[model samples]
Target: MGFKAALSKVFAWYVNRHLNTVRQNAVALQQKTFSNLIHDAKNTAFGTDHHFDKINSYEDFKKHVPVRDYEELRPYIERVVNGEADVMWPGKPAYLAKTSGTTSGVKYIPISKESMPEHIKAARNALLSYIHETGKADFVDGKMIFLQGSPVLAEKHGVQTGRLSGIVAHHVPGYLQKNRLPSYQTNCIDDWEEKVDAIVKETATQDLRLISGIPPWCQMYFDRLSVVSGGKKIKDIFPNFKLYVHGGVNYEPYRARMEESIGFKIDSIETYPASEGFIAFQDSQKEKGLLLMVDAGIFYEFIPSDEYFNDNPTRINLKDVELGKNYALIMNTNAGLWGYSLGDTVKFVSKNPYKIVVSGRIKHYISAFGEHVIGEEVEQALMGVAAEEGVEVIEFTVAPQVAPTTGELPYHEWFVEFGKEPKDPAAFALKVDKALQQKNIYYFDLIEGNILQPLIVRSLKKDTFINYMRSQGKLGGQNKVPRLSNDRKIADELKEFIV
Candidate 1:
């Protein structure tokens, strides 16, 4: 066998052996993880305050530590930012990952030295699992273009801080760094437009085999590569291109356009990593959901979505979760975040292997008129229409049209950027409305009762999202168009670029 194939065989064997053990002992592993976490942090102020010394089991841990969102933990994080040691963890965190906030301002999530190893290990395990499942690792011997955020970090209170992708860029393995495209100089450029240009120029002639990024920005890069190489698809430019490592956002909406840009199909591995921690990754090709990272330095809890907004919600650990329930994720991690709400909702698809599909952000849904529509429902409805119409949705955002000043009744306004223009716009909108009505009983009831008007689909002009992102100065790297909003803030702004 060739060198690449031989290497892949060996790597695959190792990954499978380890993963088998994990799958077989998922429950036991989670229990052990919780025990270890409690032991590790027993001396920290947070642990001591919660009586970690007396906590002996999952029930004890939950009873002592109530669920807390970012706002609740902000004060402790602020103290950490001000250079306090052992305030949260054993010592001050080495780095902070700055995540953009919707309700609150910026969130500086701690990345303790102890947590960094787990972060790196989880990411590697994700790739290794993919290789083990697919047996396609020839790309390892070729170049990879990780279209990440700028690696230039700024200091806050003597602690390094930047975007999560930027933080990860600093720790790219030495061997992979050699194979990674877009020179460090290019990656360090702060301007998105200039950095993309530099990346396109530097890697146009290289032996690229793998590309990794959030799909929207990667679509932009692929489009640029096509333009720079005389309208050639990515496959033509790099015949060895094989895999796509995507995370941070749902890949469904961007899939069609991204494949068109590449002019061929490629295997994709989805990952679930937030500023809080690396939570899960796709470990099986047979499944759609990501396998929960039971062994990672994070203990997980779940509060049902229905109960989450209640005055006092019920919290359940891994052993208590049932398949198919929508739950808001709570995590206590090695980085010293205890009972922290990650703000994302997920539904378990498998119990044996503990896999979940991210449903939506807790705050990013349209609930006007009491018809709650989440990200997963919106994505499915839109993609359904696209499938039936044989068109592709490039990007989209939805907002409630509550209390219109004009005589028109209230409804949901959809601003869609299309990769392939539909043959009939009116029909497309009708089909989308029908699909949504099918998925959400409350939305259907509202429509039937005439309490809510039909959904409106506005065709946004090409590059409308790009222009919008540029206006907000978040055109690249982990930033995305928020799928749903409560007010007309996004709708009014996006209307300026309607086709």
Candidate 2:
């Protein structure tokens, strides 16, 4: 190892030791975090309205503050947006994270100054933990790229506002400023394609070592690199490329195709970051799940996924959570979002250290006929079969076909874009369907009882998903195609590009 890598190890060692201490004292740390957050925001408008100065204990807080999604909480958030002080946090938020919302258009999540540092620290600590575990820190010296949205910000109600990735771009630590890539001008280009071209022009021959982004965009970059370099694999272009850090989407569907683009495998770390706060990250290459952040400014609550829609769902803390049960993640952050629903569901894989695997979005599912198939189940089933059959899945989504055009029984319709289409498409469909049935008992019963026919795979042309997103004017910058939907909104649009 070089001097820089050696030095990183010493620093990583201390951070890892601290993380271990936090992990071991998870319950105590969370209680302290909760107390600190409540105490800090007690004077804010939200706190005052919710009776923050009232009685003690989680029960008292829960009684005072009912759980709220962005819509339910928007009354106070709107006050903040109108330049009101102490509406959510103690003062106005440092920045407002703009995101698309289903019920309410253009949701703005508050990020207080105190909360912002935790976002930076959790991400940095994830890397440090990796270096400590693997003793691989040489990539720190090489050029790194984070394929993201433009860093340009717009003033919104007296606060800077932009995509979270873009906001983070402006805050890249001084040490990494030199190593981070695609110049500010290139990053600021509003058009994704134009920006990508500029990035490829600048970094095609650089010592690019670490790449970070959502999986789909990174795949697009690799494909662009291949075309520009006369079909050369990404590995050939940046020989020192060592690590891939990704979040915002499950990597299983994109993993095989990504490796093919690279011409080999490379190490990857998965993170669970959201607009509210940085939640968790893969702390060890050997672990199957991301290590949930315990000491971060966010105090967490979990509602059983199956019970989420119930009028009064059960809410519990990390101390009471059980393994393998899916829970809708809730957050009460220093950002001043109180009892806020994150809309994502995650399941615990390990206790003490608290490792969690994101299961699926609470709203993203197929239950048209009572078979509540989730993202995790569908991905596992399709990828399981695809892996065994030597098929490489590019992208896919599932929706229930309640009424078949063929006048047959209703079935699930799968709109898929394939990197490698199976030789026997009929057989491939059967395998994927059977695999899914095995995973979901409800689905199995529906198929066995003739309530639904086997799923139909409608293989789509290349750029099918891209075309759909572009048609909606959501082609890039953290926009993702839903894996499955209760309605036919996405599947109907995808029909335009079907092969």
Candidate 3:
């Protein structure tokens, strides 16, 4: 082997050894992280207000700091934004991750220097682990692309501020900068289509071996490449393409369409990284879950998702989390977010190594008519029926059609854009509806009681979802249409794009 490949093998081996040791002491590592966070922030404004100096255990921590979403935590964050030192973390944060929020509009999440490296390290280590297991390090030598927001940042209160992806763009390690794609000028283009056009122009003929992005944007990239190459498969355009790293959304729903775009399946890694913390990453090709980052600079607590809206939900530590039960993910991080609710839900798939599968978002679900369907159930239902029908789905969303225009019964409306439409659309809808009924008993009872009719699948025109997102100025980056909603806001707007 060449020097670079040999060196990568050695590094991957050492990193894997280090990671095994770290996860083996998961509980102790978490305890250390918790204690360090409290000790570090004891003199900060929020710390003092929450009596952090007196917090000696989880019990004290919980009693002192109640769980809070972004809006509830805004007062303290406002102080931080106004040039106040020691408001959230010590002195000041390195950057403010700007993200869209439901209640707070544009929210600024602090990222201290201490916590920034965890995000970089976890992403690196995920690749190292993959290389160690598969012995595939050649991809490191080829061009790589990560579909992300513009790297150009704006100033907020003397601190740099931008989307989390944009902020991370400023920190791409020096070694890989040579192999990274879509020149800095191209990445800074504000418009998504313009940026993709530049990316396609620059890299269409280059050797691209590794591609990373949320699946939909990657699909957009692939489609652009295909059009440029006269309808060639992605694998034909870049024959060496091997690894696909994705996160921010589940990949299964887009799998069939993406695979068709590529003309074959490829190795993939799923990561659970948020502005709050780098939570987990897929560590093994054989494992079904992403391994939790125990040594990362974050303390984790989980509240049962079912009980999340209750006045007092049961919150438990990593050691106490049970397998297969959904829980709302909470964190106290080095970034000075204490008792912060991520609004995302997850279920522990493995307790020994503390691995988890993202179940759904706490605020994004369908409970209309008492069925309480979740993201996972909807995804799995669609995935199962698609497999059985041999149809390829491009995108879909579920919303309750409560008020039928002509006085028909209420039903779940599925807006689907199919790359390969089912030969029997009604039968396809029936299969998916049945699967959802089996997954959620309440939905089955609602159907049996005649309170709701079978789900109605509205086959939409190609790129209907894309057009809708573009119209809303959310065409790319990490923006995604909600999979399920309790109301008709999205459902009503989708009427303009029906096939």
The superposed Cα distance between candidate 1 and the true structure at residue 401, in angstroms, equals 0.3
Clashing pairs in 3: none
Error of 1 at 111 (Å): 0.8
* 72-139: candidate 1 lDDT, tens digit per residue: 99988899988888877888898999988877678899998978877787788888887777777788
The order of the candidates by lDDT, greatest first, is 3, 2, 1
1-499: candidate 3 lDDT, tens digit per residue: 4566678899999999999898789999999989998999999989889999999999999899999998889899999887788998898999999888855788889999999999999999999999999999998888899899988899988999999999998888998898898789999998999899999999999999999999999999999999999999999999999999999999999988888899998999998889888999999998899999988889999999989999989988888889999999999899999899999999989877889999989988998887889999999999999998898989999999998998989999999988889999999999999999999999999999999999999989988988999988988987888998889888888887787
User: Each model's C-alpha lDDT?
Assistant: 0.88, 0.90, 0.91
Off by over 4 Å in 2: none
| Number of backbone collisions per candidate | 0, 0, 0
TM-score of each: 0.97, 0.98, 0.98
Worst lDDT window (10 residues) for model 2? 1-10
Please report the candidate that would top lDDT against the real structure.
3
The alpha-carbon lDDT assigned to residue 286 of candidate 2 equals 89
lDDT of 2: 0.90
lDDT at 32 for candidate 1? Answer: 90
